[model samples]
Structure formats: C-alpha cells, structure tokens
Target: MHDMAQAGLTKYVAEFVAAATPQDLPDDVIALGKKSILDGIGLALSGSVAQSGDLVRRHLDELGLMPGAATVIGAGRKVAPRFAAFANGVGIHADDYDDTQLAVASDRVYGLLTHPTAPALPAALAVGELVGASGREVMLAYHLGVEVECKIAEAIAPRHYQTGFHATATCGTFAAASAAASLLRFDAKTTARALSIAGSQSAGLRENFGTMTKPFHAGRASESGVAAAQFAAHGWTATDKILEAPRGFFQAAGGGYDENAIRGRLGAPWTFADPGISIKPHPSGSLTHPGMTEMARLIRENDIKSADVKRVRVGTNSNMPNALIHHNPHDELQAKFSMEFCMAILLLDGKAGLGEFTDATTQRADVKAMIDKVDFVIDEKAEKAGYHKMTTIIDVTLNDGRVIHGEADFGKGSPANPMSYEEVADKFRDNAAHARLGRSAADEVVALVRDLERQPSLERLMSLVAKAG
Candidate 1:
C-alpha cells in the first residue's frame, strides 16, 4: 500500500491513477462501471431535450469553433473535448437523473455524494474519443476517476456538503481531471499536477440546487477538468500537496482533512463494489425516492383516489428537508427537488417518469391541489439512524375518516433493492424514446455498452450518439 500520509492526498490519488490498469479492476467492478456508463448515457440522451440542455447546446453552437474535436452525445455535432464534456455533463445531470455514489452517505454530517458519472463519464468519453482510446482504456479511466473522487468525498464530506459545497461539482472536477489524465496517459507527476490544478478550480454551491445552474455546475466541472488535464500534460505547474496543505482543499473547503479515511485503502474493497452506486428510479431528488415508491404503492394497493385523500403525511430523515428545498415548486427544475411535488405527481399520475416533472405538469391545477395536501415530517429517529440506513413512513387520511399507511426502507434502485439489468435497460430505452432516438439506435447503444470492453475504439459509440434520431 502507498503511504498516503507521507505522499500527501493529491499525490496519493495521482499515483493511484497512474498505476490503475484494466487488470486491477475486478470483474464486478468492471461490470458496475459499464452499468454506470450506460446509465449516464441514457440520462444524457433524455436530458438532451431539456430546456437547459438545449440552451447549452445552442450556446456552444453559437461559438462556431472547434469542429471535430469530440462528438456531442445526442446532437450529432462536434466541438472541442472540453466543450463536449461541458455540454454532455449538463445533459447527464439536467434532470438530476444520474447515479449517486452511495459510499459518501457513510459520513455522519451529510448524506449526499457527488453524482459520479455526470462529470467523470463525460470527461472520459470526450478525452477517450479525442485520443482514440480503446474501450478497455476508457473503462479503466472511468474506474480510476470514480475511485479518486469517492475517496476524496469520503475523506472530506459531511463537512464539504454541510458547508453548502456541491460535491458533484467540487469533487467531480478532480474526478474529471483524473479520468482525462488517465486517458491522456499522463505520468504520476503530470496527473498530480492536474489534480492540484483541479483543486484550485473546484467550486459549486448548493444554493443553486433548484435552478439550471445546478446542472451547469457539473458541466463547468467537466470543462475545468479537461482544461486542467490538458494544461498539466503540457507542463503546467501546481502545488503537489494541494489536497493536504494547511490552506488546501480540505482545509479551505472541507472543515479539515480526514487523512485516516483516505489513506491505506486505495482499492482495498473497491468503493464501487461495496456501498455501490444507486441508479435513480425517479428523475427527482434521490432522497425522495423511497417516499415516492411507498406513496405510489399505498395509492395503488388501496385504490386511493386523489379527491379521497384529505391530507398526506410523509416521514423521512431530517436532513432531507433541507435537500428537498422546494416546498411549493412553480417550475420543472424546482419540482424535481420538491418532495411534495414528487409525491403529488406519483399519486396523480401513477408513475413519476421524465415526462412528469415539467413546467406544464407542475402548474396543473390537479397536481398543485395534491401538492398542497401533501406534508413532509422529519423523522428524528430516521435522522439519528443516519442516511445510509434511512427509511420512510407515509400516512394518508381519507375524507371518509379512513387512513392508509406504508413504509419503505430502501428505494427501488438502491443496492438493498437494486434494479435488475432488464429494468435498467428498460429505463434506458424509455429515456431514449423520450429523446426521439430510434429504437434500433437505442438497442445498439445498449449492446455496445454491455460489451464495451471489447471495442477497439469509441468511434462507433460516438457515431451512434451523434446520429440520435
């Protein structure tokens, strides 16, 4: 094991990235990496139609520069690798629909981790395509990036998240840089410089959660990461100890560094294989998923009508309220973070898919009426129990004096109750169809992703994404 204490956190991560190989990744880890890639592609495809995604795409087009550098995921256009990463990263996270890193939930102070794939995959794909990297190389880069990002998140979270820093943007920048550096085949010294530069550029605020800027954070992180790696490969200089110095990342952004948490465990258990990543069943805030699942079940099992319910009560972890900040959401973006909106939509529509969280749907009289009737109550016990083991209890009161109760310990897409491969494929197809991608094209993407490690180059995959229907 590398001596992280002596090496410093940034150097340790860079060395790990430099040493990572396809052989170092276990079979299950490789499979998980592929799954995460597929999930991210699906989300990006669906998000391509989002107003925010469209805006970024148009903005990039207006520049009229950097042709043939990399392919945009769903637009059949080419831009610089950094621009491609930025645009695709936005699309992947536009609806908050990407996978979440579950290991960060272990932190006592905060329950959220960076959405690992949003930035890492974009950076990997953009750089991979730019350099004609093979599928095995791309997958290796992605795995290395996730390892570095999740470890850093584990070492500094709760404090990082509690301080209103968006981990997906802050930690994700390093994740992107690591993936880019790996694909570019940078040595440890160059990779460390990239990480150090990334540390200085890392930034995003939770205050932007409900706006388009939230997804933009992921985009900016991806862009900054590609730039950092490109600069570092050309002899850019930065402090070698950017993550552990007195005024470094953990000290300035995080309350303090937890050296013990980061060191001596580079890949001891493989974070992706242990706590794993949660592919979201709903496109909204992940913390609200369990409640959405139970509410949908209760409404279905009891044949509850929207008008029959006088009021609805939901109980979740105390910290969830702060995360789901929009109580009475007026827009689609806000609706995704609003527990009331999510619950109302699930009960009103029977399912909460990408189509449900929209401005038109959120502003509907029936949906608003239901949203008004729903109330969220923080379960002190659940909060104390911690987010990783959190549960949801939902109670519904009918106008006729009857009550319905339901509880869910884990969301459908969580590791405790994981979505089957078939389900994940179904989700991908649904997302693609929503984006108007042809059925044949969507199936080809799925097949290619499943057998990704065998491809000689990402050219075919990028071509398929570019040719989206």
Candidate 2:
C-alpha cells in the first residue's frame, strides 16, 4: 500500500480554493446557495427552544467567556467565531430536524443535509460577518464547501457509513473548513493543511442520537473546521493528503475508499442538481418517519384504536436498529429516535409530531405499553442497499386477528417525493411559532428566504434571520 498522506489533495484543494469566490459559480448553484442559507437560518431559529439548543446555550453562558466575534443564532450575543459556530450549529441540529445525507445510498442524500442547519452556510455566514466578507463571497464559500464535503462523503461510500460514523460530522469538517478558508482567502497549501487538521477532528458517534450530545457533535465539528482554517491561514503546516493517505480518513473511517468517486466528478456533475433539499415535515428520525406516517394513516383510515393493537411488527433495514428501537422512552428526544416509541405514538395518537415525542407522551403508560408490543425485523435486501432505498413493512396485528400491512417507498420529503414549498414553510412556521419572534417575523423569514438572491446586502438577510425568532 502506498502512503495515502502524501498522495495529492493539493490539486483538488487548489481547484476548490480557486473557485471560492461567489462570482466563480453557475447561476443555479448560487440559487441553491441562497436556498441553503435560508434553510439553515430557519432551522437554527426554530432550535432556540429545543432541548439541545437550550442545553448548549446554558453551557456556553456558563463558560462566561465572551470574545464578541459573531452572533449566536437566537441569543443576540456576540462571541468568538469558533464558539458562535459551535452554538449555532448546535441550534441548527437541536431538533433532529436538520438535513441528512444517505451516505452509502445511491440516491442523492438530498434534504438529509441541506441548507437547514447546514454547517457550510452558517459557518460561512458567521465567519464572513466577522471578517467583513460580502454576501456573495460568503455564499460562494458556502456553496464550494458544501460541494466539496458532499463529494468527499459520496466517495467514502459504503465505508464511511457502514463503519458507523455519522457522515455529517465526519464529512462536515471539510465543508466547514473550506467555507472558512474561502471567507479568509487562504492559499492552496494552507487550505490543504487546514483540510488535514480538520480531518483529524472529524467525529460523531451514531449512538449519541436522541441525547444532547448529538447536537454537540455538530457544534464541535463546526468549531473544529473553523479552527483548522484559521490555523492554516496563519501558515500552519500538516499532512497534505489526510483524506486518501494510508490510515487516512477514507481508509480509517470509511471501510474502503473510492478515488474515482472523489476525483473525477468535482465540477462536471454538480451535486447541487435537484438541490431542493428536504425540509423536515416533522421532527423525528428521517428513517422512522415513513413508518410513522404510514402507521398514522392506517390508524386514521381504519380507526384502529390502541386497544385494538395486540401486536406490532416493524420490518426495516438494519440501520433502524441504530436509529429508533426503544421499547420505552423516558422523554421526547429519545422518542424522536425511537422506532418503537414513534410507532406506539402513531398507533395511539394517530400521528407522530412534536407533541407525540414530548416527555409526557413518551412516558405515558399507554404509550409505554404500546411500545413494548412493537418489535422489528430486518430485511437483508434493504440492508444490502445500505438503507438508502429503505422501505418499511409494518404489520399491525389487532385483537380481532385483523392483520393490516402497510409499505411505503420514499416517504414524504424524500427526493422521490419531496415536500411542497408550502409544506416546508408550514414546518418552519410550526417550529418557530412559539418562539419570541411572532407570525410576522416568520412571514418575513419566508419572504427573505424566497427573495434571498435579489438583496443588495447580506446585512438584510442576516438582520431578518438574526431576528430573535
């Protein structure tokens, strides 16, 4: 095996570095960039009250160290850029409602890791504001960073995901670093060094989902990425090819690396195509959602009562075991990732929304009993597909021996079946409604996001987004 470290990230990094300015991208990418920016802002604003958001904010406040570099999303306080990124990123992901990417899946990760809570956009926005970079410049850096991160993640394939690493944290560092480097305009060598440094810090355990630590992963990644870029801009030195080198990111994190997946498709085939990223219609694990929706529909359509459910069997891909498999959840956050809890809520409540996953609901005796009756079976075929084309086969066996089977492909908001703009907006409003910001603030956000590109200054965009909604 050759030394992957010395292999060449220079050319790739240089190409990305050269195209860091917003003026260098196509019109479509620019449009997508604006969309992502708006989405990230919306998600962060909504997260202000989420358990994760409040937890992070209190932690930062407790630190009592203010650097006044940038604004923390809903707090109206300025702090160091690194901490700002950390806090805001946490806010973005607080509700488990941020975008996701189906790392090993062939389908576009699409909405899984889009503008909402996107590390690249918010990271760029904060860094750009601190350094007086223009909106166009910040957008450019964010787009380029997102493209690079997606490509690297796409290349890692079955390895990156199958090894149990969250693609967002592992690949997001590069995205964050690229955005920071672009805003700072670091040279090729320094940018490459930054990528290496950030690569070393990429980490997020899949097991941490449903706890406060999940958002912590996002915060840490954003901070680490920014730190890497700053270090590189200052002429710091490090390994050049941290991605492909032996025992490098790909080899170590992803099971096996595919050089072609990373190299040949940089700008030719834009990943931003069909960039209508999925906005969350509901705040729950994306995988668990399809089943949740279907179960709710069945209960509503057939009027199946909780008392009618004698047994519930959920068949899904192997990944479900890691996502939502709780028999009894103590709180809503856990219910968010708990397939059993979500399904039970679906059966009992006829829907799994914010309220269904609340602490009161998850701990309800009826819900707990229903969750216990829920069990799962893994389909090898879906597992082989790497859970990308995951489908849920739900079997509800009633007390009357009435067997109801429901199967759905590409649940709501999937690329195959995307949510309408109104739907996305509705979701945004739902999350942001009870915040300090009122309906008018939410409406202004909707308008600003829709007309993002036409604005003369990012100040307007930031002002509207930063409104303590």
> After superposing candidate 2, which stretches have Cα over 4 Å from the reference?
2-6, 20-36, 62-69, 104-117, 157-165, 251-256, 274-278, 296-313, 317-319, 347-351, 369-386, 395-405, 465-469
Model 1 worst lDDT run, 10 consecutive residues: 103-112
Candidate 1 regions with alpha-carbon error over 4 angstroms: 1-7, 103-110, 299-310, 379-384, 397-402
> For model 1, how does the per-residue alpha-carbon lDDT over 1-469 read when each residue is reduced to its tens digit?
2244455667778888898888999998887777788888888888788888779878987888768678888887888999999999999998889998886445553337778899899999999999999999999988877878887888883777876899999999998999999999899999999999999999999998778898999988988999999999889899998888877888889868667777776777677887788888888888888888788778878999887889998888877887789999988878888999988888788888888878899889999899889988897666766666658889899999998988887787887788776688888998898888999988998999999999999998878778466
**Clash counts for the predictions, in order:** 0, 14
Root-mean-square deviation of every model: 2.7, 4.0
Model 2, residue 341: distance off in Å is 2.6
Q: With candidate 1 superimposed using the best TM-score fit, by how many Å does residue 220's alpha carbon deviate from the native?
A: 1.4
Give candidate 1's error at residue 441 in angstroms. Answer: 0.7
What lDDT does candidate 2 reach at residue 40? 68
At residue 145, candidate 2 shows an lDDT of: 73
Worst 10 residues of 2 by lDDT: 108-117
CA lDDT of every candidate: 0.85, 0.71
